[model samples]
Target: MIRIRLGARGLGGVRFAVSPVGAAKDLLRLVGFSPGTLTPQWRTRATDALSRHRLGLLAVVGGGGPLGYAPDFIRPEPPAFLTDINTGLHQIATTPQERIRYELAGAVNGHAWDPGSGHPPPRQLLRALDRGEDHFAHRLADEMARFWHAALAPSWPVIRARLEADVTARASEIARSGLAEALNRLAPNLEWRDGELLVHMRTDSIHQLTLDADAVILTPSVFVDWALFCAGEPPGAPAPRTPLIVYPAAQADCLPPAQDHPLIGAMRRKLLAELSQPRSTTELAQRLYLSPATASYHLQILHRAGLVTRTRRSRHVLYQRLGGAT
Candidate 1:
């Protein structure tokens, strides 16, 4: 269990920010050989993409199979609000060499290997670390750049949209409820109580963190299923002992529909036909004699495909067919 003790000031200091660098790092885990217990469809997509690319760093980064660890330096705490991959990469590139080496050494020395499995860092990486090669840091950064370009950059638009939507929903929740409720809603494993946030982790050990003046930055990540915490620091400085928590983004009820899938296309067409007049998911479900869950699922797909547009009428969200979609 991880417990964070926040004072009155600390609790008030909580804020949310999006982290593209953190999300990209999480993608490495998602697309790795053993991405833990993801939804079947997402897992299949990530695995297929990794197989197609065959990145060399796969072994080094994914050595632990599904539970592998990437070196922490790749996603050092963002010095500022991260807007894009370039900003994130620039923060990483500008990190002092000593800090990079220190983190690498910690990753090497602190890594726990499974029985019969080699260490997480590849031999070539280890050699560079041991020899203190100045070029190793640059090479590692380059590898991350390549990985981003090849695997993540193309899909960033859809990914960013989903992330932004989640953030918007979360902000709404906070406005309607409170910070504690918002935190708990992010994941089932989290509980916010009197002056303390409790995190139920898979580990047996217990840990505690106290936030004094520095606010706890809550970052939303799509790839991580469980909550993770890392220390934050000002840009260009070493990380402090205390870290902010990164929790999994709340899952939308419906997965985004694949653009070219025949079934999805057919569903969108059906939804479009029914949506000539604006209809809520509940109304459409009742009219079609389908479960609300199923109706909402297909409706969201249609909405995302540009075949439908949604409008808010007081509390109800209504959808209608868009122009040019028969």
Candidate 2:
């Protein structure tokens, strides 16, 4: 468990910012990392984007691999100003020499990644790190930019609107109930006590820090399925940033048009696109050249995500896409 002792300055400066890159990176994790591993709801959503867009560079770099202990440089400190994906990319491209060396070195199994680690950074990524090449950073940023254009751009308006709405709602909650109550709602793993925010992590390790920064950024996430995340760079680690906590916003998979939500699978989106008229699962399956069971499974997922509604008409269970699962 980790505890953040909020100093008066920190307490007063609690603010909300939206992270385009953080959401984008974690979305890659949800879908492209491993199949049938975790967060099926969110994973299925992201699979749609990945299936439609070939993130060649990101895939080669193992950007979405099981690297829970990946370098903190990838997760830059949240800028005080709510940032766009380009801003996030600039920060990554301009990572300081010291931080690049420190965090990348820490990723080897013997370092912080040990005890629990994901797949090692791919050989190519490691080679770039070893050579201390700046091109590696630019390449990474370019890849992320490509990914943003390919996968995130089309749905960014919906995603950004949802994030803004979440922030507005949270601000209202803070106004109505108070900061302590608002903090408690971030995630079940968190609580407010004795001027400190207590985080009950699955890991047994305990950490406590006195928060004396400009602000503690409270960001809302759509890609993070279940857990709350707190990310901060250690002191003297490159450009310092405000500490950040990411929590799930309401209806995390609320994007509708089923065809429009990038978090869904490509196959499902195809099925949904065909659902301008009510159709049976078997009908959808045939239209998409898929098995009935496959169609039914996708339909069920769409139903659960509030993207489609089903009805029974005598013999067939007909499903149609919802206008907007907002």
Winning candidate number (lDDT)? 2
TM-scores, all models, native as reference: 0.68, 0.68
In the range 37-73, model 1's lDDT, one tens digit per residue, is 5556665554555556654554355332323545566
Backbone clash pairs for candidate 2 read 45-263, 45-264, 46-263, 48-265, 48-266
Model 2 agreement with the true structure over 249-290: per-residue lDDT tens digits: 766653433244655777776877888789998888888899
True-vs-predicted CA distance for residue 13, candidate 2, Å: 1.9
Q: In model 1, how many backbone clashes occur?
A: 3
Q: Count clashes in each candidate, considering only residues at least 3 apart in sequence or on different chains.
A: 3, 5
Q: Model 1: runs farther than 4 Å from truth? A: 36-54, 62-68, 79-82, 111-121, 130-134, 206-213, 232-237, 252-326
Task: Report every candidate's CA lDDT.
Answer: 0.62, 0.66
Model 1's alpha-carbon lDDT is 0.62
What C-alpha lDDT, on a 0 to 100 scale, does residue 118 get in candidate 2? 51
